[model samples]
Target: MKEAIMIDLDGFYLEPVLVSIGAYGITPIYEKPEPPESEEADEAPELPEPILIGYRVAVPVPSGLFKPRYDLTTWKAALSAYDDAMDAYCAALAAYDPDSEDEPSQPPLQVDLRAFWIEGLTRQEIDNIRNAPSPKTDQQEIARLEQQSTISMLAITELFEMMLPIIMPEE
Candidate 1:
């Protein structure tokens, strides 16, 4: 069976994001092998039908646990799969209702979405807001973020150029 999938920017950047069994990949086993008939005919049990639900993602983890592999099973990471998802879910909630000062109606993300979802954002959200109806508060917020992002990027680029040597490559 085929399913529609979305590729959103979660800062994976060409790296695999470790996903839980149900949360990520799941190869389907259509049928199980038949059981043995007589006392000795060896045969495997019948299997259940399943579908590869999602992508097999890997989470880039800090080095240390069990010989420094690039992935982690713990939830310690700020951008851990579950945490990242929760953050997005929270953002959706916030965007839906930014007025509630009551502690976010959800837990504060270990890290802010504003930082991670920007480029994935920067340009898209601007028009999205303008096209939205009413006072369009969310749209306005997106516009402000867009400007702040541009300024921030320019300042950073300038700082880097001034602080470091600029070398032009020979043709």
Candidate 2:
């Protein structure tokens, strides 16, 4: 007896399977047929049954169905912006002076900074800056910049996560 199986091709396995389908634009589903029940089945020398292996259905998969949700251009830009922000923050840190009474200039941050802060300055570095007897204004400015740098880093991380499906599909 042959059974009809309906496969759902729209779930997590879609992209990787679709990619394997290639230019022919169709995916094939195959099933092994059940063997006939016979009293001599155990006594007869088993011959490989060709009929049990050949049944399959060609499933049409539209190329457009696999389009990526995230834009590659935007992902690259986010990474670049994060790199720039980190560079600026590092430059500002190297130039910092504990004795200077003047307000430390704010480092230029990329306009695209919008995300949760992940990691950046070490705890020791933050403690040294915040615990110092520097003016409240200077402490606040440095803290704000640090926050921006961390947030930018997190934004890039998020973009990469969003692009992972396209970059490395699960097998």
Candidate 3:
């Protein structure tokens, strides 16, 4: 398996904003082997203790080589992974939709076809607003809010899926 993957970010970089992809390292934690079972004279054989293997797995990024590594199981590591992925995903979204009200604090980038998906959803929402009648009842309002939340959650899932390759360094 390859250790590091390089990526080009020449067009994606914006002034005062450094978004570079490089080699990410993944720390390996081996699973414990199950104990062996034996039956002889109604006695079980003793199993040897499991061994833990620790090694660094290098990951390829879009830009160049980066040295940051993380353990996936810990809370801190999980949060860091989330933050990094979200940062890149948000940047990509903002670069794609400069006029979006939910833009991140970053400069825009050149036209990227992948960034326009959220914009499509926005357009759909606009069309829905223009065509659908306003909800008059409280139950309808609650249902609308629930639907909005579900849509937002799905958007988040989409973003996460888009960044999964870069976020997850696991084999």
Using TM-score as the measure, the top candidate is 2
lDDT string, candidate 2, 24-57, tens digits: 2122344545555567756764544543222122
Instruction: Give the lDDT ranking, best first.
Output: 2, 3, 1
Candidate 1: which pairs clash?
16-58, 17-57, 17-58, 18-57, 18-58, 18-59, 28-50, 32-46, 32-47, 129-139
Clashes of 3: 6
Model 1: residue 119 alpha-carbon error in angstroms = 50
lDDT of each: 0.44, 0.49, 0.47
Model 2's number of clashes is 0
Those runs of model 1 whose alpha carbons end farther than 4 Å from true positions after fitting are 1-136, 166-171
TM-scores, all models, native as reference: 0.18, 0.24, 0.21
lDDT of 1 by residue, 1-171 (tens): 223122222322232333453443222223334543555447554554443332222323332222222121232354566667787877777676556665444555454322222133334565676577866598889999999999999999999887665564346
Model 2 ranges off by over 4 Å: 1-68, 103-171
Winner by TM-score between candidate 2 and candidate 1: 2
Q: Rate residue 145 of model 3 by lDDT.
A: 97
